[model samples]
Target: MPRPLWTGAISFGLVTIPVKVVSATEDHSIHFRQVHLEDMGRVRTKKVCELDGQALSQDEIGKGYELSKEQTVPITDEELDQMPLPTAKAIEIVSFVDAESIDPIRISDSYYLATDGQVAAKPYTLLRKALERSDKVAIAKFAWHNRERLGLLRVREGAIVLHSMRWPDEIRSPESLAPRKVELDEGEIERAVQLTDTMALDTITGFRDAYRDALEKLLTAKSEGKELPEPAEGGEREQGQVLDLMAALNASVAAAKESRGEAGGGEATVHEMRPSKKATAQKTASRKKSTAQKTTAKKTAEVKKTTAGRKRTARKQSAS
Candidate 1:
């Protein structure tokens, strides 16, 4: 059993469910260590105070807030505890809303809420089932990492899950990021939607981290004293966006159909919209040229062998 990150009670009106918060996810990303290149020794870091030019211990560190150009205020943990806040030690349920009403973009970190002990299981299961049956999520507030956080509480896999969320003001407008807009055609949109449907899946079951897998294989080969495979050639170059949206859309739809093995009727359409056949012919010609070169080399080797045999015979006859 993994240790709980936080032990707290969920407050809802007159109900309190004692629960432990556990992280719901793990980082699978690869990590590396900084080292001295000459000796392969791990590099080390230290926390040095800028004023005294000395390494400082964790206990000597203090939190300060800058008020003005040269004015600052130091805050302590005791002082922070004295401040009045409702979400300091409890998950306070503020409101219950339809889950679909909340945008998923606002959600951030995830945590699982498990009952602390056998005695707390009843209320925990009750709340979980209630949220599941009602088809709603509870908006709650809690204090964590010295700040108040808004969270969404919902049920998942017969357990309660909490998702910390960003405030409305934190989300930026899309228009602010992309000021320029291009007009879209209805026919192009229809074809694009059709292409999307052709490539859609109920769930992403085939996805894998190819880079990680290749790195693992490389490390295994190094340990086994084996040679590494040659590096692959560069991938195909990306095409620029087509100004003729209809042609692009038709090509995309045809390509998607072809990928799904439904291109029997789309072959002509795909060729009409794309110059793919010409590219294929060029590739075929290059392969044939390579084969012809190999055949010519083989014939030259045979002719040299025949000429050497005749010269040997002529030398023997002259000597006799």
Candidate 2:
């Protein structure tokens, strides 16, 4: 387990839960380094001045905020650090609110909390079980990552988990993402909802990261000198039909009911696709096969080129 990055007491009224925050998630995606094409050497970037085209030293660099399209307001780190609030300390809970009241978008990252040296187990249990029973999450204010954050605190399992939520203005509105809707008949709606329900799994595990896995497979094939087949072309999308407000809403409610039915289904899939060792092995094998096929194709191309060159040489010699 990783050590907590920050430690503090979470207080609401007279209750204080002495807790340490540890990151709840980690990303393990492979990263790539840029290389120079000509020499096939690793590429390095140099910092240079935009105005003068001269390389800048680390000591000479300073932070600046653009006041306008052309004007910038430069500030020193020393001056910014002298603010009344310590960016490193204190997660102050300004007010109490029902956890359900907060928007889901506000919840950004979550961290696991561990008890401080001597916090009472009874109070911790009291808070956790009470929140669980009441179905209320605690909303608090804190400083993190150089800004004041509004966070949701909930007792998950035995300990309290803190989720740093983004401010409302920071997230784009749903209006910005309103382009993917389509009008549907009652039958199509039912079928699509049923398919969605069938596709849904209890938890989000056992599934491969389809896009990421495909990308890795492609890269592996390239590394092995394989030729990839072109993807089948997609048919042009037809224009979407407009939805009738009341009818669409009724259909959506029905779809939601269908989703609930899937979630509450009694029967478990006999295959138990996720959490099975066999499924994972099959996926890995598929990736290996695709990469190997690519390598074989490249070798065939090379051999064809070699054979052609030998034939040309024989023809030239005969003519001479």
Candidate 3:
């Protein structure tokens, strides 16, 4: 197990549960270090004082706030520790709220809260069971790294997990990022919904990082002095190309269905839009008017032909 980042107690109404905060996630990403390309030597960064031009050691470094270009305020750890903070050494539960009420964007890093010792087991279990039974998360305030931050406490797999959250003022307004007004056809909306349904999955555990896998392969090939792997063959859409929204949705639905091994691998199932009652009525009226005009023209032509035949017969009788 990893070492605890912070040791504190959860302060409920009248109960105190000593707990240790440890990271709930792990970093498996590959990291690179800067080095001298020609000599293959590790390059290191040094901290030097701007005025004295002397490199400083870790012990010589301290926290400071820049007041201006030429002025700074030095702050000592002792002074910060003495500052008055109600949640200095405890996770003070402020209120309980439905888990769905918290905006996911506000949540950041997560940590597991483990019971510190045997004495804390009972209260820790009590808090976990309470959260599970209530089906709600506890919003708490805790101080760490000389700053107090908002946190969310909830039961996960019979253990309590604390998720760090940003303050309300820290979140930026998304109104400016919203797109301009646009019109959508009902058929297009239905096709988009079908695409989503075709691509839906119960869980995301099957997904893997393809980029990381390729990176690992590159490293392995370099270590073995082998030829580098060739790039995969695929082309992206051309820039500034006008796309048909309905056609794209149809193709997407077909592709998703094919990937899931569903029937009709190559064909897209389109939901045709039903015509409005007024439109249907107008079309019917137009057809009736066209038929009536054609019938009248046919009757006029027949009458003219019959009159011409009668005139020719009269002329023949007079000649006789």
lDDT of each: 0.85, 0.72, 0.90
TM-score of each: 0.78, 0.58, 0.81
Scored by lDDT, model 3 comes in at: 0.90
Residue 15's lDDT within candidate 3 is 99
* Clash totals, every prediction: 0, 2, 0
TM-score of 2: 0.58
> How does model 3 score by TM-score?
0.81
lDDT of 2 by residue, 121-205 (tens): 5666777787788788877787765568888878766778888988888988788768788665777667656656655668977
lDDT of 1 by residue, 1-320 (tens): 46898888899888888989999998787777999999989997889987789998899999999999689899999888767988777898999999889999999999999898887888888888889888999999998878899999998888899999999999988876785877877887888888889889888988989888878788778889999856656344435444567776677677777777884335434334444555879989999999999999999999999999999999999999
Q: Which runs of model 1 end up more than 4 angstroms from their true locations? A: 179-181, 222-225, 234-236, 263-320
Candidate whose lDDT is highest? 3
2 versus 3: better lDDT goes to = 3
Higher-scoring candidate on TM-score, 1 or 2: 1
